[model samples]
Target: MMNFRKAATAAGLVLGIVTGLVGPAAADVPAAIKERGKVLIAIDVSHPPYGMLDSQARETGSDVETAKLLAEDMGVALEIVPVSGANRVPSLLSRKVDMVIASFSITEERKKVIDYSRPYGVIPVVISAPQDMGIAAPADLAGQALAVARGTTADIELSRIVKESGVNARIVRYEDEATTNTAVATGQQKILAAALSTANEVSEQNPGLNLEVKLDMAAYPMAVGLRKGDDELKAWVDEWVGQNLENGKLNAIYEKYFHQPLPDVIPES
Candidate 1:
């Protein structure tokens, strides 16, 4: 009899041969998840309202709760893989997590690497700074230091606006939302580009900083992110999101953390 590891290796080679003979195989992510009996979801606990630790130090937030509901509906155990804002994509691509639900917004750039479910929530990107800063527009940020989480929509959008507007502001990027927010709160950086909820959370934590939104950039719809070619999983996720949205459960969760209703418009994926 073959050892367990040897048997697994033999099985993999056989599967590879079969796959080669078939030319290609459609992703049966849904079935794979079912067989595993657990779904690994990535959530950014560093970003507030979307994901964070509660007073009890347990994980709790909109994204965390959403993942819990999804796992429950799918009849699978939920495994929360805590990730930083910059880690969502890498974690998915590396197969460390089955999907990401870290308030991840849909973008054409991201779509090239991964698929997304329909919009589940919306977040406003803003430039938060001291109340006295006269940064009413992107151009006004010239020569200022604006900190943002690397690889996030806030970072991408702000970089685009700065380049187009010919603003010379220094864009400082951090590995996570918490560090980005800390830069602003500690006065290491006077400005921050992040979700409105993120700015609000940082403000509440450091009231003396008096951070206020100087620029309300835009609201972006966030959705669950899956590895590319997960068509079956995407379909299931889309349907689940639609069902929850229609039943108002998604909105209830959104309102609980965001303090507002879910957005009415849906963007093209």
Candidate 2:
């Protein structure tokens, strides 16, 4: 009677051996990937809990682990390529990566260029500000300086809201979320449009900032991104997403990193 951990390890070894012998199924993988015997997955290691480098400088996060599982399921070796929000899609389009498992929100604007699998997770874009800012809602953002990373969903949503509301808020764009968070935390910026997870990470890392979410702007579901017309890869990823969600494996990974139960927004299948 072996323990669960040992049994699972044994099962994984056997699975790996069987996968290596049988090879990747042609119906589930891109022809190039099946030829190469590996899949290149794009990930943004700057965003925590989603993708980041550990103390040993190895990629470790929900997305990284998920990509590993995806490659294993596809019976291929994994090759993670680091990418930023601005470059994740371009990397996939240029054939630099086979898929993007970063926190890529499924949106109509992106759909024009790339196809997305069913969402695996959800991230809430939030407006965070100091308690004294009096920025309780989107309308209150008028005349305030909002910080955001350019090309990100937060930037797009904040811009849209301001334009639709006819507000004259000042938007200050940064190269990345870390810099944007710094501007907001240090009082250089009055407000920040960022992911809820990012806001939490910023607050935890810099408690003196006293930042809090003033408004819930939008909730975006994240999905695997691939080049347009890749039906085989898309179908494989969709099936993987459905299987993981149903088995509680995805939830377990989410909870392990985020320290909370899987959000209700994650699709069941």
Candidate 3:
């Protein structure tokens, strides 16, 4: 088994071959890819500014721009496959999609099954409570009922912190952010949500909801994912990302959705 860095290096070489720029195989087309001159991309069309359906119901976003740039860099066309959050991984492994440009978080657990490009963005995990609730930090929520979406990284991270760090918060699982955000907004639970990006999205979309950000908890990274051992694809993506990061293209994309520039660097710690 090759490490991520090594696999990426090899993948870049293969990309060169496919583009007819280098390698002996450049003269002998790989039948698996020769007929299809497009990069199959899996995207969460519902996730905005990254991937989403427009008012006209057309698929477009910042990630779409990024994907087009990558395809250009790879010297290939792009075929985007709109997908939901739950189906992202299955689509990758089953070869239905060659890459995931969706807003996927990189985790130790997920890295085992799929390879990820270097992180492109950072999302802060916040512990949110109503203004009147008097909760200011992770510790302040101890012994109180708190809600989070089941099977999400936020729930797992909060649970780990509560158990290991000795926070007194009692965990409650909600089906989705809507219910959790509503519960918190209505003051049903002491703190109705523990999330990173989704909470921010909810708060911004609904003015009636007042969510105070508590950043004492952990922050996670966002990255693109590919099928395990697909070194060629991973290398192509890494080089494409590096180019964008250097040329101010990525900063512009970030600003379009976030109203800010991309950070100088993503904190590895």
Per-candidate Cα lDDT values, in order, are 0.83, 0.79, 0.66
Query: Candidate 2, which segments miss by more than 4 Å at Cα?
Result: 1-27, 263-269
Could you give candidate 1's per-residue lDDT for residues 176-215 as a string of tens digits? 8988877787889988899888888888889998889898
Candidate 2 local lDDT, 108-216, one digit each (tens) = 7888899999787777788887767788666888778889987788887898888998888898999876678677767788678888888888778777777788888
Q: Name the lDDT value of residue 30 in candidate 3.
A: 28
Supply the global lDDT for candidate 1.
0.83
**For every candidate, C-alpha RMSD to the true structure in Å:** 11.7, 6.8, 6.1
TM-score between candidate 2 and the true structure: 0.85
Worst 10 residues of 3 by lDDT: 23-32
Once model 1 is optimally superposed onto the true structure by TM-score, how far is the C-alpha of residue 213 displaced, in angstroms? 0.9
Which candidate, 1 or 2, has the higher TM-score?
1
Ranking of candidates on lDDT, top first: 1, 2, 3
